[model samples]
Target: MANEILVLGATGKTGKRVAERLQKKGIPVRAGSRQGNPPFDWEKAENWATVLSGIKKVYITYYPDFVVPGALEKIQQFVDAAKNTGVQQLVFLSGRGEKEAEEAEKIVINSGLHWTIVRSSWFMQNFSEFFFLDNILAGYFVVPKPKALEPFVDLDDLADVVVEALTDDKHNRKIYELTGPELLSFKDTTSIISEAINSPIVYEEVDMDAYVNTLRDYQIPEDIIGLMQYLFTEVLDGRNESIKNDIEDVLGRKSTSFREYVVKATQTGVWNIQNGQR
Candidate 1:
């Protein structure tokens, strides 16, 4: 019998791709989103049962992530509920080299269900799809200039791995640290962006305090600012400044390179949108 998969955060970066890939292969999928049928909201735990009634597996990509405060308790609640409700498997999207994320991983490990963890590096799409996009279009990309190197991973490869994990039993009880083939500094990544967009996108490094103040000035929520601070201060502090072969080992292929991701993003034309400043 085939499992009915519930993809939490189904509209998110990784979850959307995973959902699409599963549906393409004709897997039974119930998209778990606030807008989905029998809506699933992390903050609203009351909605869990309606969404999980017939689901057997889950692709859980926590919003913002499990590192944020209150997330651990939420994970514990969700895991206990899933285990009791008879969900058979779980695939958790996790961050690489984060202690709090490690703690979150443990909840799944001890949940007494089949589980796989995708511990990922910084995403290449952050420049186009996330925090840096608006600034990139404006030609001035600003962030804390961490000296750490990052093997930025492609969401495509991540989706592939996630699909395999959800569908095939080979990946159960394993943790895959997914990353791109090469490590790149923020400067180097922006250089690729410059070439791809054929524009003068510059990378400017600022101090941590300035970055936080800027976020506050934008009236961004305190919780979001907290995640950003944790990422720049703790996760990006040269601790994960190396590459791993886990993606290739599991997929039986080499990981995507930063240049290839840049080329593809440029082809999509989303990265080249111009603002008046640019």
Candidate 2:
């Protein structure tokens, strides 16, 4: 029998897609979640061994983000656990332009196991599937960094790269920086979505302080709020504005654009607002 690949954060933006793609190819997959047969939770260390059993490859995506405090230590501990459990390969999802995430990447690299690090830019799904979805449904898009340009990557492209890394040896010991084909500012992003959905969406460029306050007013957790602040003020400051062709190099195809993603998402009724509900 083929070895099972464990996908942590199995229900997340990238993990879900990665797991689906692997399973579609008839590969064995162990969904690493709190609800799995052998449950896995980052906060709980006792079950690490149980979750790692018979798993030859693991996809590691930290919850919240790798920029959070103590993330490095957690990653180190998990790497050690995976090593001791006889896992052979690891594929890690990391954030672009984050020093902290880079530190965590080092842990995976030196684990003495085959590893692939995928450093990714901001995901385009933020507008349709995540935090920005509600704002878009309300016909308004508010963010702090209006001038900073980002090469927002499609999750499908990211998942494709991750699956390849897990299943192939050619991607081993390689670091892939994945980004979309074009750079876009917040205004450009909202404009594309506005045109795609045929809706008049308001775009507001607020100061970081105002954005932080709004997050607090909405009762967003302080840890998440801190991650947001760091991403907007430090990481999203044009450092990752350049496009990358790593996705093409890995998948033998071009990365999906934000406008293409918006058009596809629009057809899914995720952006459709009816009676003030999404």
Candidate 3:
């Protein structure tokens, strides 16, 4: 019966923004992170009771991704725990076109709690805030699916929708497929970034096996590598090329376009090369 809302993965890309929005609105927020008070970790169920002790609602953003093995079990366990701890609502961040994610969504939907599912496409912030940033900074965007057209969703827009869902009961029992206004391939995205930053950025397409091997060579974790492979091979196979109006439906405004995101990102100087380093 507590008023504070717990945001799992509170330090992540979407969770961080959602938590900030809630705090700015003067809502009580309990950040769910290893460093948080009553710290929460997905691999550690022992901390769940402490983290959910006084939490009324929870914003769930599973780490690594929901597509991995054993994800459904973890989600099931967390959902059960949330129910036991008097959590009233759940706003789950899910991946677009991921079967495992959808299955996890099912678990929340049937949990007897107010629930909203934000099934999202690839985030535009990946170019600036995630693994792709290294490639962008290096001026070479290499991947297996350079020509796959994806309607990348802006994290800002996603955060807005998530915050609305968390605060508004009207969004409960809804599944919002969030996407941007337009579709763009990796090549097109790189070109836009290049123009925005006034730098030459190249897009290279390699085979999936080579990409996986390259990740291995870089010492990336096997789970992360498997995720990348699955994403590039299955999810990004033109399955998420279409845009959605869910953002506008939720926020009553146009979803941010990829080009618009690129323009704003450039102003932040994230793509700026400083002294031969990113």
In order of appearance, the predictions have TM-scores of 0.95, 0.96, 0.96
**lDDT agreement with native, every candidate:** 0.87, 0.89, 0.89
lDDT at 22, model 1: 92
Which ranking of candidates, highest lDDT first? 3, 2, 1
Candidate 1 yields a Cα-based lDDT of: 0.87
Give candidate 1 misplaced runs (Cα > 4 Å). 216-221, 275-277
Please provide, for model 3 over 1-278, each residue's C-alpha lDDT reduced to its tens digit, 9 standing for 90 to 100: 34789999899999899999999998988989998998889999988988999788999999988877788999999999999988899999999988888899999999999999999999999989987887788787788855468999999999999999999889989999999999888888899998888889877889988888767765778988888888888898777879899999999999998899998988898888882244
Return the TM-score for candidate 3, rounded to 2 decimals.
0.96
> Which sequence of candidate numbers ranks them by TM-score, best first?
2, 3, 1
lDDT per residue, candidate 2, 79-180, as tens digits?
A: 999999999999999999889899999999999999999999999998888767877887867789655788999999999999999989999999999999
Residues forming the 10-long window of minimal summed lDDT in candidate 2: 269-278
Supply the global lDDT for candidate 2.
Answer: 0.89
For 1-278, candidate 1 gives per-residue lDDT tens digits of 35769999899898899999999998878989988988899999887877888778998888877776799999999988888778999999999999989999999999999999999999999887886777778787678868698999999999999999998999999999998999888889888888878788867889989988877875678887898888998899888988899889888999999999988888887875553345
Candidate 3 scores a C-alpha RMSD against the true structure in Å of 1.5
Residue pairs in collision within model 1: none
